[model samples]
Target: MKRLVLLLTFLCPMGFIALNAQSSSIFIGATGGANLSKFKFTEDLKELYPASNSLLGLNGGVTIGFEVQNFTLHTGLQYIQKGSEYQTDNFEDEQGTGFYSATEKLHYLSIPLLIGYRKYL
Candidate 1:
C-alpha cells in the first residue's frame, strides 16, 4: 500500500542512522540554552507602551551531523519558548477604555538544516 511505502521511506533512513552511530563520519549531540526576550517600540509608540521587561525562556534540542571530506551537513529538532511581558501607559482610547499590563507566552518546535564546508588553515 502507499501508506506502507510512505512509512518505510521515512523509517528506513532513521534505522540506518541509528545503526551507524559508531561511524566516524556521523555524530550526534545535544544542545540547550536560555533565552531573554523583549519587545521594542518606535518613538511614537514608545509613549503608549512605556514600560516592559524581558521574559526568560528555555531552549533545547538534539543535533545530528554528517561529515564527508571537507563538506558537512547538519540538522536538528528543537523546542523554543518565546514572548514577553509588557505594560501599557495609562492611556484612554476614543471610548475611554484603559489598558494596563499583560504577558504573552509562546511555544514552538524548530527544525533546522544546514550545510557547511570546512577549510584547513
Candidate 2:
C-alpha cells in the first residue's frame, strides 16, 4: 500500500509538470471522453488477447492535455475496472439459484496523443 501511494505521489505530479511544461506552446484544459476497459492476462500478449472492452461497460473521466509542436498529448484520471460473471448451463435446470458474482474496484491513469490544428486570434 505504501508503494502504491509512493508511485502515485510521483506519477500524479508528473501530470502537473506536463501541465506546466512550455507555457508558450502548452495549454492545459479539462477533457472528458469515452474509454474502453481491459484486463491483463499476461505481459507478452498485449496484442494477442481479445481485449474485452465490454467487460466493465463504458467509462468516462477528466483529462489534461498539452500541445507540443504539432502533437497534442492528453493524460487522464479514469474511474474504471475489469469485471466478469460466471455461469453454467445444465440440463437438470436451465435456471438455477446457484450462481457466482464478484466485483473489483479499479483506479487508473490514461494517456493519449492527438494531432492538433492551431488558430491564432
Query: Top model by lDDT, which number?
Result: 1
Pairs of residues clashing in candidate 2: none
Query: lDDT by residue for model 2 over 8-110, one digit each (tens)?
Result: 7998687557657745354555544554454545665433433323344445566666664444666666544445332322213345654323344455556
Alpha carbon lDDT at 100, candidate 2: 28
lDDT against true structure, model 1: 0.83
Task: Identify the leading candidate in terms of TM-score.
Answer: 1
Q: Report lDDT (Cα) of residue 5, candidate 2.
A: 91
lDDT of each: 0.83, 0.52
RMSD of 2: 9.7
Q: For model 1, how does the per-residue alpha-carbon lDDT over 1-121 read when each residue is reduced to its tens digit?
A: 9999999799868756754664438789999999998877789878888888899999999999987666677899999998888887587767666777789888999999888899988
- Model 1 worst lDDT run, 10 consecutive residues: 15-24
Record all residue pairs in model 1 with backbone atoms less than 3 Å apart, i.e. clashing. Answer: none
